[model samples]
Target: MYRLLIADDEQLEREAIKFIIEESFPGSFTICEAANGLEVVEIALAFKPDLLFLDIKMPGINGLQAAAQINRVLPECRIIIVTAFHYFNYAKEALSLGVVDYITKPAPPEAVVETVKRLIVELESASFKERLAAEREQQLQQITGYFEDDLLVLIAYGEIEAKEIEDYFAILNLQAQTFFAAVATILYPNTPGASILEIEKRVLNKNVVGWVKEYMQKVGRQAYIRSIGAEVFILLLAEENLDEYQARLTGMRLFTELKEALWKEQQIALNIGIGGLCNETGQIGQAFSQAKYALRYEAAPDSIISYGDIERDQQQVFYPYHREKRLYQSILQGDIHASQQLLEDLLTWLREHTSCLEAFQQKVYVGAPRQLTLQIIDCAGSKQMVGPAVDAFAAQNPNIKIDYIIGTSPELPSKIKAQQMAGNVETNVVLTGYDAMGSGLVQQIWERIMPEQKKSFPNLEDNYLPAAKAAFDLFDGYGIVFAWCPGGPMFTYNPDRVKNVPRTTDELLAWCKANPGKFMYPRP
Candidate 1:
């Protein structure tokens, strides 16, 4: 229901308008009446009416003057001028004041009803649009969160490309050029040879990321936080040129507050390493390295160390951060020989620095896949196949990281297309069936393998079965066949309702023709 206010100097005129409205709309409106301009303005302020009818001539303050005052406060209120004269000047002034319509003294009931109906339609439409906009905003925020997580993963692995960064910047509306990386490590129980998974469970159960985010908000800083195993990577963004002093100050404050908060909430201690300021977009990896380097000196729990505090000879210190990253990537890609060589080199260097290899064993994370990440969206209902395929793949390629989500086939094409149009496409791979494949084909969003790249998998099609090969041919290089299920379309009906089920295409057609509303099918 909406509020309606009728204002006039004459009591008879107000009654007539009210009777007409009540007769037409019935219980649609909560109607109010005002005898003069002052009374109307006061009632408008209190009632916040959706519609108003104002007489042009009133005692002292006129209707136009009252409307101007009301318009300032309740701009959304629809006002109609009720006047004794049909002067063009009054009509012009009413329009200037945002009056929807003007009805002369003793308005026809039809004219009054018509004007009210039109305004009601407009108000309803505007309200619907507002609700729709709010819903879209909520969905956009969720997508932004996903992009943020993806960006942090990319930054942590140091594999972020310029285009990928640009896309994220557009999605996040990041106007900052300067950034610094911070690594917060959980000071878990000093159990001999503790696994990363075990350590993560202990800290993650306490929700350290949530605490860190809360502290960040309290301090009014912009940063992306990602929890990887036992460590949390924070990429702090700055709009202006951040000097080393300012960066260190920010890190100290953030880490100090975070450290205190964690201990207070869950008795979990955090040791943070703050890297130096980096202005370039591509040098975030360097910041991460510096943070990791600083973290090595964290001798005790609740320790906060900055790269600037560490005094080391840059030329003498042997830190193969990039080589170690490459080794991890190699292991993820199932390159045994390259990873073996890299591992030997790292061990040989470790042997020279330390007397016993036993001490270094505790520092290294065994059986942990922390380097590369992939996000997979599946719409084919192939979880039983893809889950084991990914596990088997991970078993051989131990360093590869995968995040999977199941989606509906009908929504995948449009969702992905919308993401692309918004300049933030998050799906790395889409595992979908033929119906969605047809939709994707029309959308033209899929990335096709070029002829040159086909050399890497020379005999790809020859290994497939006949039916699978036919499906692959239909894709036209957009997708590949990983598995096949032998099944035909089946009908679903109540046993008591339909004793004889449709056995063939003709039977289904006949059933559908006979029972139009009862027989329904999903999109092809």
Candidate 2:
């Protein structure tokens, strides 16, 4: 709803304009009135109305002056001048003062209604654009967050090149030139009766990574974290490189706070290892190694081990945690090339570090299903009708997952045909209208539900209404009428305005001709 202010010294003029608007466009506006020029400016500023009607010849500092002041403060407020005279100078001044239009005194109700209607349309259009822009910005932010996570994973995995880091930084719009790396290892307690898997599930299955991210943000640190199985790698970005002492102090403070919080609140224990400062993007891999090296030391669970304090001579055993996570992420994102390259890297590592039989066994299980998504293309606004049926189907067939893509009746068939032509049939099922079903039948896009399949639903025909049965018959065995309703042409008319209800198209046309500007109908 929009706010509207009508300012005039003549109370009747204000009332006339208010009545005209209320009768024509009820519930569209919240209205206010002003008796004089001072009241007009004061109420306009305080109310912050969207549209204002100001009388030109008002007592003390006329309408033009009030409009000028209001425009300075509320530039978006549309001003309409209400004047008794149609003098050229008055219009010229009103236009110069940014008045949208002028209403001559004793204006027709139709003219007043039309002006408000046009302004409302303009306001709605502007509001829609604002909402669209906000949604776009929100989507951009979400995409940026995904890119940040991918970059952090790459840094920790030691697979990203210097050029790739630069490109990521540019995409993320990051100002940080240096960063610190830390590795946090979740250490499950050795329970007497509980199994290792039980303990791990209780601790690791909790959103520990999410907690750490939220905690880091609360502590005012710009950090990115990625969980790789039992360990989480943290990248704390900085605008400049920190000295050895500063890095140690900062790391100890953050790690100690995190360690205490997790143990005290959730009974989760963390053994953290802090790496030395990284001066450039290329040094992130080395820093990751340092953090891992520091993590291997047999330190107290609460105590954070810094690489600067650890001995450099000892070599830490290589782990494929990062590489495995990178490969998993690549596969999930459908980056086939990256997945193949990472698979090769893992195979090479296995060749050097393990036996041939072990490598062969691992390779054999590479394509095992971890997660799968089933996509369904559906007509818009049909979710409420189809959602419960889909839910029931999913409940009975628990293994089948479903996702929906909403489209128009015409658009759904085009999208499915396009996907089929591209040799990537993403749409597993289509929930659409009869028009699209008929179109799909013509396009040979639908297959008949065979007689063998009908055996499973022996009572399906008995349950269907006659309308649905008729629709099914029209499909010629290519489709089934999942839902149906019986409805015909309908009309609604005001009894006072429309004395004789038209029963046919010819009668309706005759009535429209007899009483001009008295007919209304919705577009198909």
TM-scores across all candidates?
0.47, 0.38
Residue range 64-133, candidate 2, lDDT tens digits: 9999899899867888888654433344345546577777666567778889988787777848456544
Number of the top lDDT candidate: 1
Which sections of candidate 2 miss by over 4 Å? 1-126, 189-191, 196-206, 315-524
The TM-score leader among the candidates is 1
User: Positional deviation of 356 in candidate 1, in angstroms?
Assistant: 23
Report, for every candidate in turn, its global Cα lDDT versus the true structure. Answer: 0.75, 0.74
Clashing pairs in 1: none
Question: Per-residue CA lDDT of candidate 1, range 74-165, in tens?
Answer: 87788889864443324334554657667855567778999999888878884845654464466557657767876777666666645677
The per-candidate count of clashes, in order, stands at 0, 0
Clashes of 1: 0
In candidate 1, where is summed lDDT lowest over 10 consecutive residues?
A: 84-93
Q: How far is 247's C-alpha from truth in model 2 (Å)?
A: 2.0
